[model samples]
Target: SRSLLKLLEAKALIELSNQTKPPQGWPSSPARNLEIPPNLNPDQANVLQLFQNQREQKEWLLWGVTGSGKTEIYLRCCIPELEAGRSVLMLTPEIGLIPQLLERCQRRFGNAVVPYHSALSEGERLATWRYCRSGSPCVVVGTRSAIFLPLPKLGLIVLDEEHDSSYKQEAPMPCYHTRDVARLRQQQEGCGILLGSATPCLETWLACQKPNNSIGLLHLPQRIAARPLPPVRVVDMRQELADGNRQLLSRPLLERLSGLAKRKQQAVVLVPRRGYSTFLSCRSCGQAVTCPHCDVSLTVHRNSDGHSWLRCHWCDHRDEIATNCGQCGSTAFKPFGAGTQKVLEQLELELEGIRLLRFDRDSTRGRDGHKQLLERFAAGEADVLVGTQMLAKGMDLPKVTLAAVLAADGLLHRPDLRAAEQSLQLLLQLAGRAGRGEQPGEVLVQTYDPDHRVIQHLIAGSYAEFLEEEAAVRRIARLAPYSRACLLRFAGPQASLTASAAATLLNHVANQLREADWLAIGPAPAPRARVAGLSRWQLLLQGPPASPIPLPSEQILRRLLPKGVHLAIDPDPMEL
Candidate 1:
């Protein structure tokens, strides 16, 4: 309360009598407070020129390569708006990125840069929101929730890492995407929208291809230092099995890690999951232990003392390891697949005397855990950093001379249409983490499907070829990029009620489907049929590109849903 009041007092925002109007005049141009102009390549210069030339609200995709200086372009482009005495809003995908981004923004714009995100205390959030609303030229760097901030004089909006799924909000009313919301705000407020990503989402790429004139695509194909993209070595797990080397780390990765450790160079190990094991099964009954509240099997987690426990990732439920199998009353149990914890354990055993730091949902559960772990890894306190999906995006560790993906197969074979694209993006991003500094870096991807197209693309480091091949498949399947997609999920405590509610909604949607180009699929059980004791079902909607697909509004849907049942509608969903 004291902090909030003090801030309010400083701005004279607490007393109506002392409230003064904003400054008498808004500067027509920036004071050129940036000590020096950012150096830009020809391609970056062209993109910056386009952004500066936009007099009206427009949307553009800055599709740059992994180290192609996209952030530099963003910083340069945003300056003009700030100079014109208008606020700029920049959005990143995760809280883990806010610290680094905030640091850079602060260095560039000083106190004018306001950091807004859930990580801040309520007073800080309110102060930032009020500052942005003070009609002063400033920059607001934040996560998805920052979209709703009231920056009335906003002139430029940026969505970094646009391909990331974190931009999509899954709960509460108006579950809108950051990119979409930014575009909407641009339309309403007459601001320029810039979407930057190394591996652009298929939808955004396709949107850029549409001859909208106002929407442009800027390509930055080369890294800033002209460093050659790291060479990705695809290790076939099948070959390892045939060679009688059944280890999680491939021979090549093991050798590379050994060399890295010997040289005191840092390494990053990318795992697909977080717990010690994906699932555990009873050796006697061949039955997998499942979460009591969720349909998914319980993951095996081990504490520092090495005591094992079962945890439900969906509901945060914990259970002790049973001495006997529930089904057959047998003592033996077996773990199914490896996760980050398992890989960390294996690395310690295989590469002795290596200092390893683990970064994942479990390990980084504390408030400042992400920042602390990353700082330690960056400071050379740990030789190896083991993580899951969190390590794939927006993390630039220059000291990371070696990067390895334990298993790419975990990302593939998913029931989602964009699995292939996601897998490719993830591999390429992980590969890009290496070779960013003086020492040449390399990536080793271990996968069972060495012949897979995604693996082939990674090995070649040809994003164009991968996109063309993936686009062709998407076109043939009439899935995203070629079409617009939406997901409607229904969940309830009772299975019968959930099914009934889903069926009713499906029938209603079908009856209301007047457009011939629109299609709806499924009222079937979702990928995970039950979560937190709630039975779930899903419906998919697809329509022609750029066409609007109408459905019940939040108010109407809330009324239609059965008691205890809830509905979640995601337009252009990242997952099926």
Candidate 2:
């Protein structure tokens, strides 16, 4: 009876025992005057036809190049579903992308477009949940969390930028990926699912290649109206240094930014980090300032009122920067590495009277922070928008003629297997932001290693070629897309205790799975040894290609580990 009441409250089941009259009918459907866009290109039109013909297909991948009118294809596919009185759920990887996408969906579908994301207030989310439960046909545009929304008569699910790591929930319990959940929903609701991306993850690409796989493949090879992808020019930082130029902005990139005002165009500058500097180091001892709580260096953050402090990006720990080094008691200190704030400061100093806007997490805060900054940039309030990786995701700005990446080496030199692939994806996605309009766009990538594989692929604009090569390497090494992995993380106040607990749990699982295809990899310290004062250790369970690893139940795991130690099991973890 309690469960029945709960279902009634969620509008999933209506009670008729106490009703004297018939229940009221559902609310009136919104007016459907969908503003259909111009005709789709041949590639997109072909995908639409394929989608229509394969009604029994449960999943499809739309592998389209950037600026190839993928969004138009999405709109076209949804039109028929909406007309059939079914609902469409559109998912984006980031909340920052919601505003632009929401505006477009609303413009096209009118009041039938429902915007849902974590950024919305609790009350707003509750109202949306209720509305979707009303069983009315509508389109819901949101981020990864939107996968959980209940849609009656769900006809389709669309995941844009499916390659992004944001779709994976790394923290908290019950870790999962949005795409996996979407597939689960498809199985339950019998609806079609579409994954659209410019640079698809190796896993999805491989899945589509299987001979009898249910996932179909759709390709859009060219940009709409025959506009070319932006040409990328890699600037060797080593060469720039040899030429007596040590500025963060390369000579050519600076020259381009300098003429933005005269050329009457905008530019987007992407910096990997967000603070004024990556870390503060002692000149004498060469020791960087480290966070007390986290096992990482403290970043230098400067406020508008001429105040600076040290912050740990991992734990949000803040501390005052000491004048002297802790290790050597040296008075001389230097800030190392360029961040978004430093880039903005450099631009203000290099170009006179040039407007600049910082678009990173620090700059965008509160409920409407992202939308406000984006609107300002779109209105031409600033000539240059300096930001972090958020600038690389699915933003369509027609007037942006130049896109520049600062300190690209930071992105390339990550300690992850997918680093190169992700780097190329980010660079290409950022390049796509430019050249969407009338003028051809130019991309400048400043890196110490200009001939790096990722950089080379970026210059050639050969995403498929890069994927092919990368697949070979991954296949050889038995990495992801060829193997299955689950990460078991243990954290506690004491490092020794946490490590011992992790080791015990690993031994327990290994003994149980000794005869199975799964292989146990570690009981070692995590990549980040500690965070927010908790010592962390991890164990990885890997399986054969295309095989699922069966992990121990959470209850059994908790019982095995020490009482004070916390355990988190992540299936198909995106990050190590």
Candidate 3:
């Protein structure tokens, strides 16, 4: 029955195979009339020429700065492939980016452009699948899952914003990275692979530096129309406190908002978290409110009716707010950190008649939520757009003149190997959202630690220098680009049982590694030890540079673990 269903989904079998008179062909639409092309700048033309000159190269990297016409280059490269009766696949990091990209591609290629993502209905996905299998040349603008589409006569694959961690899937079984899959497909189909990014990942950067490497490199250092990069100013929050300003909005940021309103301009405010507050704490005993099913603090969320509750971010558990402290029976409680909701409230109180729209996960839940809110903002209906990291992913808003980060300390203090690199990429991308038009722009970052290396690099607008220093540091530590790592995760209902299972697996792996050049660490509790009533533990295996980590078969691994435990294997994990 399972095999039959698979065949049906793949369009290999019909409803009645015995009495078949051939199925009707799907309807096709004619392509729209092509519009006059925009004249390419010198840099963009040079990059396109490099691509044309190296048509046989399988791998290429397009390293361009923000607003440097990278998409123009992509569109120019697609014309020749489509004209030659071959297909093109353009992959973006987020679904929210699809609408704009789809619009652009359709404007140029008309009916040949197809959009695909997880939000589509089952019928829509099935139709798209059948269309791709029809052997007609077309272009697919989609997210990660679209990589599996059966694109016959595939000619080129483009990955935009390649440094984004969103390209890696971490849940369920068969954890995989889209970049790796693209490489495999390129080898099988003999297609060209182009990776375009403002800030490339360390692995890709290192790959392009090897002697006699096959991957070609291209660069675009200047922004379009000779616009200068926005000047970043770091605001010291400690000094603001010493001067007796107790509001969440720093004085400098407040003044800028007022100025923007007076000039009738737009601004984007980036908050690290989305709820009302980070967590609630008892004023008397200093005990933070926690989730019963998980080992992490519960964030406070407030609805429009002024009702508030506690929610566990990892497990989706909800509970009523506590009136009295569980530890000391105290009645006083306070929120420790501010989020998007709290920032919205503070902005309402400080400035009158200021139009604001929330752009985080909570607000954008409907089918057309992202498109609607973005259209409203772009049409000059909102003065300020408050959001999370979604606002930083290559959104080209021309009217936005001020970009502010409310809490830089939160992004800079993460406990991970690529924390600094990720933080810098995010901040730079956020800054790129501003100063994209005729008017000059400015960025204001609020941080307690003004001297942090991330902030210093952001202020200087020094991407190359930062990458060089970071590479040196990673080399000394023998981390990524220097070595490869694989993570083994274990989970069970009981902490002791999970630990025991992990220990057993660790012993098996240790014995295997005794004869190889590999390092084994763990059988320890994971960062968030418990989630959704399950205790979690992990083991890490590191292999030498450019070497593959040898893992046991799935059957062998399952037999090694206990009955009540679950195991997951992740290679090239985005997070440790």
Candidate 2 clashing pairs, residues 3+ apart or interchain: none
Candidate 1 vs. true structure, TM-score: 0.91
Better of 1 and 2 by TM-score: 2
**Stretches > 4 Å off in candidate 1:** 1-38, 54-57, 514-517
Q: Write the per-residue lDDT of candidate 1 for residues 1-576, one digit (tens) a residue.
A: 878878898997775354333221112345346446567888888877876676553788888888788888878877778888899899999888877777677667765777787867676677776777778888888899989889879888999999898898877645678888888898798888889988888777766766766568888888877878888888888999999998887888878777675676888899999899999998878999999999999999987799999999989999998889989899999998998899989988998887889999888776667888899999988988999988878888888887899878879878778888888888888887887887888888888988888888888888777887888988898777678877888989988899899888877778665554678888889999999989999988888877777786778777878789999888877788
- lDDT tens readout by residue for model 2, 1-576: 978887886895665454222111112466466676887778888889998998888899999998898888888888998999999999999989988887788768877788788887776787777778888898899888889988988999999999999999988878999999999998899999999999999888888988997689999988889999989998899999999998998999989999898888999999999999999999998999999998999999998786989999999999998988889999999999988888888988899999999999988999878889999999999999999999999998888999999999999999998899899999999999888889999999999998899999999988888989999998899888788888989999999999899888877777666767788888889999999999999998888766656766789879988778999889888888
| Model 2: number of backbone collisions | 0
The Cα RMSD of model 3 versus the native structure comes to: 4.6
Model 3: per-residue Cα lDDT over 307-383, one tens digit each: 99999989899999978999999999998898899999999899888889999988988676787889999999988
Which segments of candidate 3 are over 4 A away from where they belong? 1-31
- Please give the distance, in angstroms, between residue 61's alpha carbon in candidate 1 and its true position after superposition: 1.6
Give Cα-based local distance difference scores for all models.
0.82, 0.88, 0.88
What residue pairs clash in candidate 3, if any at all? none
